[model samples]
Target chain A: MDVNEKYFKNISNRERAIFEGAITMGALFHQFIGTPINIKSAESLEKSIKTAMELQPCINKVEIEINRDILKKIENEYEYISLTGEMLDVKVESNFSDKSAVIRLKYISELKYPLMYVEDVD
Target chain B: MDVNEKYFKNISNRERAIFEGAITMGALFHQFIGTPINIKSAESLEKSIKTAMELQPCINKVEIEINRDILKKIENEYEYISLTGEMLDVKVESNFSDKSAVIRLKYISELKYPLMYVEDVD
Candidate 1:
């Protein structure tokens, strides 16, 4: 059975693009948020997250940038901090048919919330 | 700034409920997927995931069950295995005003995908 035909026939291509990207963006945030990390481990962690999330359906790319500034200031006894939404800047690109979208997760200081939104669509 | 007024006014209450629950469900899956786990740490990991996800906007509660059968059989060199979506069964409950939704993530063997869907709404 065709997975998309069975599970995703209701939504339009644009909506599917958004849906897939949203799921991935949400997945990226929650999946990596509590991993132990310092400046030294940041790059490897970022790479791992990118590779992992990209495996999801319709996901073409996952770009992650963990805040190095936050990692640099770590003074805890453990010498590393659990990752948080505030430290993540992410863009997940997904496509369904001719439509595609980029979903972004970024910490917005004004609201003090990590905001996820549709950054681009086509 | 009024976050709901500014960022969430476009979606209906039911949509917002589904959206929030979906996001939380995705976050829950990704955030803890790679954590080192064995039967001994499964309960603690489940508790931690539930507590952390319950803090998200509109999310009322989170329920997590990590597969202990898989953990019990672990024979890896490290004595533990990284958490994977196949090992998780989760529900995220979210409400926006009178609208509420429960999003679920469970692995389906036929699809070979950990599916996320709106399990319930009211």
Candidate 2:
């Protein structure tokens, strides 16, 4: 619960699902995380993303664009301090573009990281 | 690109490394995704996240919090129309909690979902 990536390395199998969530929306994730996945359904996209999210020790907020007209925020599940007992209706694409523009931001440094690390967030 | 969940299923090898990024922060992606991953380095966590994000056909803005005081927005790499041609300094924790709060919101329905599906926006 220290909030760092090492927690994942302790358990991840480095599979293809890495390309199926918010991580998929980032520039850093695309550069060097895992191999490319290849699923193409709304169900898989949402499920894979959900699978990745549940790993967090804490839940905060989940935001999504419903039809792109409404940006809905699901804060209760996190507020309740528990993962939803049901399935989510979100998903991701398992492909990448050579010319896709994305952003990679350094959000936090594990309060417990042994060494200090700073990213060149351009 | 027609976005959907099944897309990830077509290629996910049921790996870990998933608990290393934004997907690790979602409520739905938590309920059901690939198995768990295991890494323990800030480098791996950041790398895993970046690896997953670059698959989208388009890149958007990436937001990060520098020590939680400075919320930085990196939207250029995404705007320049390409993934950041370098490594990022973000990381994720590969763990979960039974008593943690999280949120899951349905965002899109892929301009091309075969059937009609609407989520309970509560």
Candidate 3:
């Protein structure tokens, strides 16, 4: 059974690229939002997330940046905090057939929301 | 700043519902796939996940079911295993104005992929 032919025939290649990228971006935000982390663990967590998310369909690359400045300012009793959208800046590149898209997830200060959008597509 | 007007106006209400639900489903899968868990921790994890995902835009509710049979069979050295997609059954319900959608994520035995799709929409 061809997964693409069965599951994605209705959408255009461009929409499929956008769809895959958007799904990945959403997955990245939700999956790790509550993980306990400190400055020492941030690098490893970022690497793990990058490696895992790249395994998704059509995803060619995943880049993650966790804000260390926030890690350095931890004042809680645990000396760490659960990861949140504000700490993440992510880019996921996906391709379906000849079409490709770059999806971005960034925390917008004014909206106080993590925005996911198609950054570039062709 | 009108978020719906600025970022999501291009997509129809139905597409927006599908998009939000898909994002949440992806987020749910990636975020929790690596957590250490045993039978005792599964319920708490499900509750936490449901609570957190409901906070996302357009998401009305999240339902998570973690397979406890697998949890009971754990034979690892640590008495727990990192959660995987095979052990999860999830549904994310999202709404965009009058349109609503239910997004589902479940592991497919034949494809060996955790599939996310629009299960229902209006």
Off by over 4 Å in 2: A1-14, A20-22, A25-89, A95-122, B1-88, B96-122
Residue A86 lDDT, candidate 2, scale 0-100: 21
Model 3 residue B84 CA deviation in Å: 1.6
**Candidate 3, lDDT over the whole model:** 0.84
Ranking by DockQ: 3, 1, 2
* Residue B115 CA displacement from its true place in model 1, Å: 2.4
How do the residues B1-122 of candidate 1 rate in per-residue lDDT, one tens digit apiece?
A: 87778666655677667667767777777667789999998999888888998988889998889988889999978889999989989988889899887777888889787887656777
**Model 3 lDDT tens row, A6-69:** 7666566876676678788887787788899999999999999999999888999999999999
lDDT of 1 by residue, A1-122 (tens): 77677655555677667667877888777666779999999999999999999998889999999999988999988899899999999999999899997877889999788998767777
Q: What is the C-alpha lDDT of each candidate?
A: 0.82, 0.25, 0.84
The docking category that best describes candidate 2 is incorrect
Q: For all candidates listed, what's the TM-score of chain B alone?
A: 0.95, 0.21, 0.95
TM-scores for every predicted model: 0.71, 0.20, 0.74
On TM-score, the candidate that comes out on top is 3
* Candidate 2, residue B88: lDDT: 19
For candidate 2, write residues A1-122 as lDDT tens digits: 32123222232222212322334333222222232222223334444444553342221222221121111333444322212212112223231222111121222223221110111111
